[model samples]
Target: MALIILAHPNFDKSFANKTIIEALENSKLDLEIRNIHDLYPDFKINAKAEQEALLRHQTIVFQYPFYWYSMPAILKQWFDIVFEYQFAYGSKGDKLKNKNFVPSFTVGSSESSYTALGFQHFRVYEFCKHLEQTAYHTQMNYIDPIYFHGTSLAAGYTPDSIMTNAKHHAQKLIATLSQLQ
Candidate 1:
């Protein structure tokens, strides 16, 4: 099973994230949704409960929007609090070992804009290097990320295009989970 930890500050107003969430909701796979903003509007996180949730799943998916080239404030806080030294690292931190860490996100800019010659000046992988390193430190497998670019202020995109990507997003995630060794 994969646990999707979604953190979107303005979830209600999101078109791309919402579409993907709906697709996941309608899928048949074993999934657990944790909308952090809805769960802890005050930024209060229950570490123990979150740890227990991680222990139950073999895969952990952090789904969110790209905020200032990184994750939202609440999600970053979740990482700081939930992935404790004794639990996610250090000599005794083996609880997360062998698990998979997958990051699913939506980027506002075009995919090409993330290249070296483009505005972002780096690839998506470079942007998410911290996440990959976190997974490595925790002894977990860092799976390929799932991201949909040109999702925000999509000047040239239509509603149908978004929906199509949403449907494909869900399918790809399920496929990735199934292919995991």
Candidate 2:
């Protein structure tokens, strides 16, 4: 089974992320989802429980909205707390070894703006090095991430369009999970 760690800070106000999660919920995939923000609103993470969940699944998927070229602060905090020494890394940290690590995120900017000659002046994949290195440090197989750009309402995107795209993203994610199984 796969474990999806949803790290949206303001989930109730989300469009793309919410739609994608809804689509996944409606699917028949054998997966578990942890809405971390809801689980730890006070920012108090249960490291033991998280480690146990990691042990139960062969694949771990991080679902969130890209913020400031990285993950939301809560997700970063989750990593800091949950992925502790002797558990996710270090001598006895083989607990997450051999598991598949996948990052699935939604970007508020357009894809075109993420190129070298574009506004962001860097490719999207470049931002994933941190995550890739995290997977490497923990001895997990880092799969290519799944992401959708142009998801912000401020980017002139309608809620319906975002919802439709999110559904497609969910379908692709479901297929990927099926193949992993």
Q: Considering every candidate listed, which one attains the maximal TM-score?
A: 2
Go through the candidates in order and give each one's C-alpha lDDT.
Answer: 0.87, 0.94
**Candidate 2's residue-wise lDDT over 54-147, tens digit each?**
9999999999999999999999999999999999999988999999999999999899999999999998999999999999999999999999
Q: RMSDs, each prediction? A: 1.5, 0.7
Global fold similarity of model 1 (TM-score): 0.94
Candidate 1: regions farther than 4 A off: 154-156
Backbone collision tally, model 2 = 0
Q: Residue 156's C-alpha lDDT in candidate 2?
A: 95
lDDT score of residue 90 within candidate 1: 95
TM-score of 2: 0.98
TM-score of every model versus the real structure: 0.94, 0.98
Best by lDDT: 2
Worst 10 contiguous positions by lDDT, candidate 1: 151-160
What is the Å distance of residue 110 in model 1 from its true position?
Answer: 0.5
